[model samples]
Target: MSLLFYSCNSQKKAQKKEAETHKVIQKKYADLLNVSTTEIKNVRLYAFIEEWTGTPYKYGGLSKSGIDCSGFCNVLYNQVYQKELPRTTKDIAKQLDKVKQSRLEEGDLVLFNIEGKKNAHVGVYLQNNMFVHASTSKGVIISSLENPYYKKAYNKGGKV
Candidate 1:
């Protein structure tokens, strides 16, 4: 009986800690994205992206100081999903099961043809069609997959 009571108590404490952590994560991401926490459906993804927000884009760079679209995608997958992904946009695309644009979900990889080449750019899909990527012209930023620019370059969404 004592062991049962202790286990139940420990479980409750763990649940409380998780709830608090989630609340804090939501608040941080909501403030960073200028939206309500309710708007964020994937707390892990949002928080991860928030950490790298505003970092400069650099070719062949991998750290916060500078990172390219593919590098960002690679790190995000490894850190958030605990999966290893290819380091280049093209190779990363190959690792994914192709998903239609209309069927995309959070954690999907959105591939693009920004340089008139397939899979030239990549970003991680967030809720409401938004994706985070490191852009050569804009550094790290969140953009809508529906934006005219992205729509024009949009290739497909990928899920590993």
Candidate 2:
């Protein structure tokens, strides 16, 4: 059977205005089989995860010049994702649903307790078990979920 080939601009426009970014259809795989429309909204979220790379880390500030952990995620929500989020790490954590580690997705929010407390640090998830945040010691960067420091101090995550 032959399926109709369709490309949509309206779909792209609404998606661009939402929390997630792009929907990727692999030509390599789609050539072999039919590709569904909402293939992976979860995957689309990962696109914005790398947006803050190289942004400087700051305290009580939010911008490319510098960004705190929660500020970094906040800026991402306001600008790139065109969504609004709470300001502080504590508030942001409270705004999201507490989910299991096994259910984590690309756009899911990841919280860490760098000081062994609760809701002290936050990050936005990237692809392949990676996330981006403004490090207190370093600038904004991507890191692995299994990173020793984050792994031990992890709190909980939720959808932004």
Candidate 3:
């Protein structure tokens, strides 16, 4: 009877600790993204994006040192969604369900036509119209879909 009580107590403590840790993570992301912590529905995904915030961009690269837009998307999907994706923007786009930009949700892929090529660039959409991508000149950064440059280059959004 004593052991049962102890087991229940220990489980309760563990759950409490987990809740507290989740709160901390929520607060951290809320501050970083400038939104309410309650708006953060997926803490692990938020943390994953935060982890690569400042990585540099490199064509055909796939690590912290450098990563292209599609490479970053591939890594994100593989790690956060446990799904493997095609390595190139065109290929990735082919695998995803086409979605209108107005309907984009978190984790959706935003396509761009920077060089007039179909799906020339890709970024992972986050909440609030923001998306993270490996910019050729600025490396990895978050930009708004409303940005004039992106607006002009916008192609579509995709859901895997």
Candidate 4:
């Protein structure tokens, strides 16, 4: 009886800790995305973003120390959605069905044409016009679609 009681107590404690961690993660990402905590679903996605946030950007790089836009998206899609993505931005764009910016949903791809190049950049859509990417200057960061730079460079949203 004592063993069973202890097991139940330990299980409860573990569950409580997990719930607390989920709340913390939701709060953190909600603040980043400028939304309420309740809107921040997909705890795994946010947790993954939090873990990789601030990683340095490197051309053709694919590790935590350095990652590029497509690489970041690749890692994100693979880990979060269990989906495999093409290695390059252009290739990834090729494989996706184009989605309008206003129609984008969570886990959709946001393609960009920076500097007048087609499909030159990519990011993973979160919500409320916010997407996460490894920017050339900012490394891993969350950015808004409404930003002037992205606005002009915006190509289209994409989905698998």
Name the best candidate (by TM-score). Answer: 4
Q: lDDT tens digits, residues 45-119, model 3? A: 877877898899999999999999999999998999999889999897788799888888888999998876888
| Reference-based TM-score, model 1 | 0.79
Assess each prediction's global lDDT (C-alpha) against the native: 0.86, 0.71, 0.88, 0.93
Residue 125, model 3: lDDT of 91
Clash count in backbone of candidate 2? 0
lDDT (C-alpha) at residue 156 in model 2: 90
For residues 31-63, could you state the per-residue lDDT of candidate 4 as single tens digits? 888899999989999989989999999999999
The residue-by-residue lDDT of candidate 1 on 32-146, one tens digit each, is: 5567889777777767886898999999989999999999988998898998889998888888899888888878999998766988999988766788999998888999877
Which scores better on TM-score, 1 or 2?
1
Clashing pairs in 2: none
TM-score of each: 0.79, 0.68, 0.82, 0.92
Task: List all candidate RMSDs to the true structure.
Answer: 4.5, 8.6, 3.3, 1.6
Give the per-residue lDDT digits (tens) of candidate 2, residues 1-160. Answer: 1232223665666777653334333332222223344433443333444455677788988877888998988877776678889999889988898778778765678998876678899998644566778888888877777888989888897786
Identify the candidate with maximal lDDT: 4
lDDT head-to-head 3 vs 4, winner: 4
